[model samples]
Target: MDNYLEDNMAKILLAGESWISTTTEFKGYDSFTSTKLEIGCTELLESLKKLGHLVTHIRAHDVPEDFPWSKEALDEYDVILLSDIGSNSFNLSNHVFSEGRPTTNRLELLKQWVLSGGSLMMAGGYLSFSGFEGKAHYSGTPIEDVLPVLIKPYDDRVEVPQGALPEIAVDSQITNGLGKFPEILGYQTVTPKKDAQILMTVDSSPLLVNRTVGKGRTIAYMTDIAPHWASQDFMAWENYGEFFSRCIKWLNKDLD
Candidate 1:
């Protein structure tokens, strides 16, 4: 095993990325329902782990109850990522929704955490950014203030069945050793902030954007980390592991 020092390893909190889908099949006036649970960020999780990062994943269903609400708990990780999850999952807790009790606003806590030197990243999906039908609802939230892009108030998904190839928009540490990237099937459309660095783009829209918020940093990857949007080809790219691991390293300030 490689003897890596403690500081070389980053503790990462990964919320969302898993979902359950229910489907009904009808045959000759008889219908049956089947439900399946799927995880979208397995590749990303494995990549981070391979690079020696300790990752804590809170699945979509478990996020409402399991996600950290206190600053001390949130400060335990060097970086946090919200992937394929909505703001409601963090804002509406079980107590607040079911019993109408007041709870700590986790979103606001996250914003403050980032401003205090914690890195944060948001990856796109049907339930990320403005998300499908605007249900994700992070447009004007505190999270948006820390992000490097402006979230659309409405649905932001741009479907590209023909595939949209990722292009390096600027020279940055995140894209340093990364060569030609693979084509992605789709991505959320977001505008880069004035002071934000655009590392990559797809279909001329911001794909990877980075910004510094006070003493911390933030990144917005306007595309899925897994399939449907992250095409099979994109996942299988030779530098797939390197590209993602580099992003985490940059966020943690491990890379200069």
Candidate 2:
């Protein structure tokens, strides 16, 4: 591991990035259905783990129930990452949905936590930051206020099947030594906040952005860490692990 990363080990809580799919097959007059579970951040997880960072992943289905609802619970980790997940998971808990009881507003708690010195990051995907059909729906939410970018109203995704290469919009420690970025298939369209720094861009839009919130900081990486958006070239890049490890160090305030 690079000395830069070896000294900045952090406890990271990764939420979302997993999904269940159901498919039905038809043969003549008969039909069969099967369900499969998939996780999208295997490469990212492995990279972080290799750097000696402790990562806890909460799958999409388990987010509503398992996500921390209190500041102390949240403070256990140095950073929290929301990936391919919507606000609904944090909004609608089992108590509210099933028992018709009120629960702690996790989103609001997250906002306060960040302001009080917690680090946060949101990665892009189908269910992330005003995602497909606006289903990810982080727009106008408390989380949106803390993020480095403004989430657009509906369907913020910009699908570029031809591949959109990301460029360093500004020089920063997070991007310093990293060479040219490989092309990404797609990314969300977001506007950088007035005080935020646009570290990376794709198609002239913000791809990686960062800002300080009170005593803490937040990052918005508006592209998937996995395939379909993160191209094979991007994933297979020699500096893939180094790049993300640097991001973690930056988020944890280990990088000056």
Candidate 3:
């Protein structure tokens, strides 16, 4: 582990990774239903926190209102992690979609922020990177231009019930000291863009990719940070915390 990572803290805004679902039950033609709220980034969040980083999570439902819409507001954080959230959340704020009020375009702001030296990372999920049935819909957004990979036009998730292992594609500080990675259950399918550096892969497909945008940096991890994809063994890996910490350092150019 790098001592610098332990001594220095990076402020990170982690958005999404939460959802609500409802189920209905029937008894003698009468129906009852229940709704539950679930979060998916607990392990990742804990891992980053343990590495001495300050992370503030913003749920998907609150993004339209909570996400920073100006460069000044965004300056508070060094990095932004978008996990399991769609463009719509940032594009259609409550003020605009519901109340017909004018609001800043957060996605465009985020793109400019990255161009001006803020780091950004996008982790995979059903609501990430042209996710399930293409509902995530980041295909033509400004964010797409800043990403290191090109998103597919349709649902990009690839399920691996038998588990898939990652293959190192490039030698870099982020990969230093990294041993065998635990198998993952699934990941998104994306093509690395020109000039983008692929750090890792799963069965020949890109698993982690990154690139520089203007003075900043951006990275894409094509798998969930926690279960349904990350698997129990992955979350419990001995180097989980170190791996994420190194990723942050690399994205911030601290390891360069």
Candidate 4:
């Protein structure tokens, strides 16, 4: 664990998505409070810091069309997280696809990074997985090649009013030792890939999944973090931090 952490420290990049032009748009309601320090990834960073990780945070705004898809940036982090951000962002104008041709394509770079063993995790939201009517369709990107779930031709999001109680995986490393955790508010229903291990399942679908992409591992949490969108349960739930932290640990355990 220590070797993985130390060796992978500089390789972890935490990319957050900010579509709202103003913080004023955010009203801490349901389970989110106006004063809560970490909504989205604000708290997630703190939690990662608590675990001794000094994360490099990049917002979707910071990336530009001419932005260099530097291998320095790619190799710097062991894991790159996409939370509610779309696939098109990385393919922005400045990025190069192959042979260093200038274009909006850092994905080929990201693909090489992962194939060479870099972890990636996607927490659910509008910019994730065929998000909101195929808005953030990750299916066509190199990311889709690594992700455990197949992106439906259209949106894969399912509205669950009654909510679902997923059956836990007995041998899940993520859920291991998490004794009696509070239930998640709700999960966005999705189809699972055969290559992926359905850690937790609902009905016949995969809710929590883990898969190995190249030499790196990827985990998918099909749920939201901010409340009212069914993430209220986890945010309000005491074990929210624990569960998320465990996920981070699994993704960047080598970074420690």
Candidate 5:
């Protein structure tokens, strides 16, 4: 790891699905056909700034027919975020795959990029991991093979009965400082792989999770990284920043 990452600033890819959050608008699909930079990027960047990082954001909002896969476009950052961006933005875009699968070069670059020791954070949303109606399925994608846990083939909604208290699934340095059942406002749930050291859980399923792939690392957030939870936490609790900061530090900690 670089010392500058600990100093005043570090490069970060504050990426998210650059599109509208469609639920019932796209004929039953949370249509990712028109992704946009997630509005939460501002808030997340603000949070990252508190830790001292020069953040850059990438919007895969519009996928032109001649889109190019450039590690130069993504790999230089200290961390890459796959927040709410489903299969369309990275895999199904133009020149990426003719049939919703990543081509060899793109896949190779991504593999090498991570294997060469890049940091990646995978967060969930309606369009993220096995998202709504399986429209953004990952079980069959090349990304699945690189990741430790295989997402389900369908939506794994983190549904809790109204007034239900959010629960912690496992112990980790990530959720170490927070109080018990600290009242997370909202989140998604996934049947994370047993190999994944479950960090938090809702009902026996994983919430915040971590796993390693080659020389790089991966983390999964079963929730939106924005206002719904962020705002709610600010309005209702005190340790939200601590929770979030732990996640970021986990992703970009110095390995030397």
Candidate 6:
């Protein structure tokens, strides 16, 4: 176990990407309903795990209650990944919303954590980066203040059923050896923050943006790491895992 905690390994906290859904089905004059549980970041998680990074996944509903609210607790992770989760998860905790107790704001803690030398990454989804109908709602959160890109106030997802290929926008050591990527189905549209580096683009929108925040770093990938937006073809691409590994290394400043 000691070997697993080596300096080369990055500890990552991956929040969100898990959800529960209920569906109603009709057969002639009768109706039936079923509930299902799903996770969207399996591929991305597995990829990171395979690269020897330690990952702790906190589902969407579990975030408000489970996310660390203290800097001491937050120190356990070198990187925090907010994927497909909305702002409410950080703003409203069960202690405040259900138990009638005041609690520290997790989002504020996260912002401070990043500023004081922790890496942060936001991967896109329906509930990420000003998601569907603007329901993801991170525009006004403290998180938005540290992000490398500005989230549009309205719904930012651009559906591309026909697929859109990512174009390399900058030549940097972080993106070295990365070749042609597979076309993705869709992506969230975001403007790169001033002084932020636009690493990649899809159509006219920023696809991957990065910037340094104090001693730490922040990266925003404006597309899903899983399906619906990231197609099966994209996930199955030869460089899929390698690409993500590179991003993680870049965030940790381990890549040259």
Error of 4 at 113 (Å): 0.9
The prediction achieving the highest TM-score against the true structure is 2
**List of clashing residue pairs for candidate 2:** none
Error of 5 at 55 (Å): 1.7
Q: All candidates' lDDT scores?
A: 0.88, 0.90, 0.88, 0.64, 0.61, 0.86
TM-score per model over all chains: 0.94, 0.95, 0.93, 0.77, 0.74, 0.94
**Predicted candidate 6 versus true structure: per-residue lDDT over 94-179, tens digit per residue:** 78889888889888888898999988999999999899999999887889888998888899989999999998998866666778
Candidate 3 CA-lDDT value: 0.88
Clashes by residue pair, model 5 = 18-35, 18-36, 18-37, 19-35, 19-36, 169-200, 169-201
**Evaluation by TM-score, superior candidate among 4 and 5:** 4
lDDT by residue (tens digit), candidate 2, 1-256: 0111333488889999988999999999999999999988889988887877888888889999999979999998899999998999999988999999988999999999999999999999999999999999899999998999999889998999999889999889988878899999999999888999999888888889999989999999999999989999999998888888788889999885
> What residue runs in model 4 are displaced by over 4 Å at the alpha carbon?
1-11, 22-39, 65-68, 94-104, 181-186, 253-256
Candidate 5 residue lDDT tens string, 1-256: 1112335544766555456563334656454354333455555565656667666665546433322367675566767667766666655554445556546354456557776777667776777778777766766776665665678887766644342354666656776657854444556656666666676665555677787777877777776665454345443455555566667667666421
Which candidate should be chosen as best, given lDDT against the real structure?
2
Residue-level lDDT of model 4, residues 1-256, one tens digit each, is 0112332233456665454432334446634323222335666665556566556666665544422376676676667777777776766543343445655357777766777777788877777877788787788678777778777656767666565555676576677766654444445556667888877765556767878778877878776655444445555566556666667677765322
Candidate 1's displacement at residue 16, Å, is 0.7
In candidate 2 the C-alpha lDDT for residue 123 amounts to 94
TM-score of 3: 0.93
Which portions of model 1 show Cα errors greater than 4 Å? 1-7
The predicted structure with the larger lDDT, 1 or 4, is: 1
> Can you write out model 3's per-residue Cα lDDT over 167-217, one digit (the tens) per residue?
899887887778999999999999999989999999899999989989899
Model 5 TM-score relative to the real fold: 0.74
Per-residue C-alpha lDDT of model 1 across residues 100-203, encoded as one tens digit per residue: 99999999999999999999999999989999999999999999999999999999999998998999988888897678899999999988889999989888
